[model samples]
Target: MQLTSTIQKLHERAPRLGKALSLATATGVITGNSIGASIPIWFMGAAKTITGAKIADDTVIKVTNYWINSNNALIDNILPNKDWRINLPDDVHSKGKYLLISNHQSWVDTSIVQYVSEKRLPLTRFFTKFELIYIPVIGQAFYFLDFPMMRRHSKEAVAKNPALQGKDIEEAKRACALLKSKPFTLLNYLEGTRFTKAKHTKQQSPYSHLLKPRAGGLALAINALGEDIDGILDMTIVYPDG
Candidate 1:
């Protein structure tokens, strides 16, 4: 609380320095938390793979929950106050399975999802590119946590090599299957990419605010986990400043 007040006061006094300090503080905290949580996750992930141990699987998720809670704490205590209006169904539970679809606008959208979902929903996982595995702790943590990883093929590449066609879909299905046994909140950005005016212009989007949603990913998720999912959730986020 004192730190938050100090930072806010500093911002009022010198905006640039305060902004820099805020970024530095957030980056350091998140980085340290990720690294610390990832070590146990990696070892437990390996154990789960090797032994098919439920304890290992549970431990990984427990650690991940702690990691998220730490970040949520940072948001509550360290960041500036704002009018954060979050509405979730009363029936939603941490042990329920759900498919969450949302508009893609900026990187902060994912963080917002985390913020709203801390204890109200099951652990949130999203589709990630397979190439992200090469990135350090966070990427590997995604794999450990069973976040679906996709290998998307461009139309041109698929056209040139017909063998590549449908491979990504098959891989995505396999990834989704990994979550069938556990409670989860799977997030899919229906827009497929971040929304931009240039992209909106190029696509000649019909909607005033959103890009034309690509339904294939949602279809794939349903085909893979339809029976287990409790509900399909649609979340709309509005940024007043944007």
Candidate 2:
């Protein structure tokens, strides 16, 4: 009873505590990840200066993976009980290239996925709306890392400009090409958005845990990078206690 009461009190005060923890962790991860990411650039720069040859894709991946692993370690230490899990095949690490098709249930899902994949797998990058690219630090990083940002248009706009209809698809292909040139994991959430009670009731979702999977995004990914992908990483995340 006392424990329950204490937990209730913590819940009541969770917002403030969560905000502080998130800020502190974010500061540490961003700073660490930035420095970590720069190490590879530095190495490549020195290699180019000394050897007069561009760093190989495999070598760049190894260097970046080191930083990503360090970032994941920091994340794991901070959120030990966050209920994040990565479900991939036994040969997944051996086959570093993957297409992770997952169901989105919360805003936290991406962070959880990235946190889990940091070092264990390759860096998980996503296709996002172009507007996100204008968002200061995030945009800069996305641009630097060649993250795909699509400009979504209305039906009328597409109808008027037929050329624009397939632009997003083309952009996705380009992004996949960049990943294929190296070794990386592509993260695709088939559900599109987090599952909410309102959305669930609207869609009449078949599963208690997930909505009906959307195929367009996943299809585009498979079609564009099908040959390069080692296999599908079908991940399912469950948070039993909300």
Candidate 3:
């Protein structure tokens, strides 16, 4: 708490330096936590793969929850004061199975999701590109946690190689199947990509603020986990500063 107060006071006295210090602190903490967690995740992930051990999977999720909790603590204690209003149905719980749909805006949106969902909902996982598995700590953690990794093929590529057609959907379904046995909040960004003026203008979006919604991912999730999902929830994030 003292550290938080000191940082806030610094912000009041020197805005730029405080902001820089805050960013550096956040980056260091998150990176350190992720690296520390990933070591165990990698070993357990390998064990799970080799032995099909449920305990290994559970261990990875526990580590991930701790990692997220650490980041959430940073948001609560280290950041400047601001209004962060989150509204959810009373029925939502950490043990519930849910499909969360949200808009895509910025990279920070995922962190916001983590912040809002700390104790209110189950650990959240989103669709990730399969190529991300090659990245260090964070990517490996995502893989071990069973985040649905999709390999999207462009239309041109699919057209040239007909065998690639429908492959992505099949891979996505296989990934989604991994979550059926567990409590999860699967997030789908209906906009497919982050919204930008240039892209929105190019698409001639119908809405004043949002881009066109892609139903494919949501439909895929429904097809794969429809029977297991407790509810489909919609979330809209507004950035007052933007």
Candidate 4:
């Protein structure tokens, strides 16, 4: 009776104690995912260059599955109170090419999306800022993963050079060509960033759980790779506590 009473008191004082430990566990899982993220990038080029025969697609698939599974496990740990789910179709294997769009709620949203699409679908690749390419090992890994990088210019600079109009699209096309032989999923966050109370109030967003969706990025993606892609996978992620 005494031990049980003490346990109850501790639980009462820190209702979220378990959840906090779970978050730490989730952070560890993401660290594993980050390490897994580097493996393919580390070996693919060196192996291919050494052997003169391109590495088999199966090997790449295995490494990506490890990364995605670790990521999903991380999501499961941190969001224990929430009921998480994934909607996967029967044609996952054949549905190689996809343009995946999702609503972004928090920083965790990207990992959740990647975890959901990793194996059952295809590798999740997205466009990132060109500056991220200089971010030490991770940037080089992104380069290996063939994640597209772009440098955004000021309006005045663009006005000075109208020829830059189609440059972004051209870059996307080049990235698309690099992954043509293998199946892959292209991920795009429709909101483009984490939703905050400040942003929600500023935008006057209609959705209770999301900020206003930007159409330009989606439109650009559709225009560039719409023909090759099977369909758009619309994903929504919600965090009740937030």
Which residue pairs in model 2 clash with each other?
A: none
Candidate 3 lDDT, 8-80, residue by residue in tens:
8998999999999999999999889977988888999989878979999899889889989999899877788
User: Per-candidate TM vs. native?
Assistant: 0.94, 0.73, 0.95, 0.74
* Regions of candidate 3 where Cα sits further than 4 Å from its true position: 155-160
Give the higher-TM-score candidate: 1 or 4: 1
Among all candidates shown, the one with the greatest TM-score: 3
At residue 228, give the lDDT of candidate 1: 91
lDDT of 4 by residue, 98-153 (tens): 87888776776777776666547777888787788788657765666667666677
- Give the range where candidate 1 is weakest over 10 consecutive residues by summed lDDT: 74-83
In candidate 3 the C-alpha lDDT for residue 27 amounts to 92
Model 2 is weakest, by summed lDDT over 10 consecutive residues, at: 76-85
Steric clash count of candidate 4: 0
Q: Output the lDDT of residue 236, model 4.
A: 73
RMSD of 3: 1.4
lDDT of each: 0.90, 0.69, 0.90, 0.68
Cα lDDT over the full model 3: 0.90
